[model samples]
Target: MNPEDLQKLVTMTMPYGKHQGRLLADLPGNYLNWFAREGFPNGELGKLLALMHEIDHNGLSDLLKPLRGRGR
Candidate 1:
């Protein structure tokens, strides 16, 4: 994914849900999987969630560690 998207994963908070206010990068794989099964929300949040799902699915979540706190 692009740098801004990666950065957002670590900085942007989930706007709503049980995980509201949680970092997108820190969301559990199971939660992302739930999205995969249930379908992600619309717009930018959905895009980020889908990206995170792929990262978590492939066990590459750590790739985002260095980008934390640098999001726009």
Candidate 2:
């Protein structure tokens, strides 16, 4: 995964859907899991979702903490 992507998770908002406008980093685990089960969307959004899913799945979300503050 690209290091920049970790930062993007904090910076980027969900472009569409029930979570639209929410930060990717803040999406609930259930939401991410739904994507995993249903298949992530295409392009960068999908990749980021997959990455975030992995992070959440393995309990490594704390690794993103240091990057979160930079977004604001």
Candidate 3:
């Protein structure tokens, strides 16, 4: 993934869904896993979700902490 994508994960909110307005990095693993089990949407949001899924799945969510701090 690109460096900007890592940044985006911490900054961008989910545009739609039950998690609407929730930061991508903050989405629960189950939600991300749901996408993995089902299918991700099309476009950049899809890509970001997939990436976030990987991050959550691999237990690397903590890696986004600094990036989340930077957004403040």
- Give the Cα error of residue 15 in candidate 1, in Å: 0.7
Model 1: how far residue 23 lies from native, Å:
0.2
Which candidate number has the best lDDT? 2
Backbone clashes in model 2, listed as residue pairs: none
lDDT by residue for model 2 (1-72), tens: 989999999999999999999999899999999999999999999999999999999999999988877946
Worst 10 residues of 2 by lDDT: 63-72
Model 1 residue 34 lDDT score: 98
How displaced is residue 31 in candidate 3, in Å? 0.5
For model 2 the TM-score comes to: 0.94
Error of 2 at 63 (Å): 0.7
Q: How many residue pairs clash per model?
A: 0, 0, 0
Query: Every model's Cα RMSD, please?
Result: 1.2, 1.0, 1.1
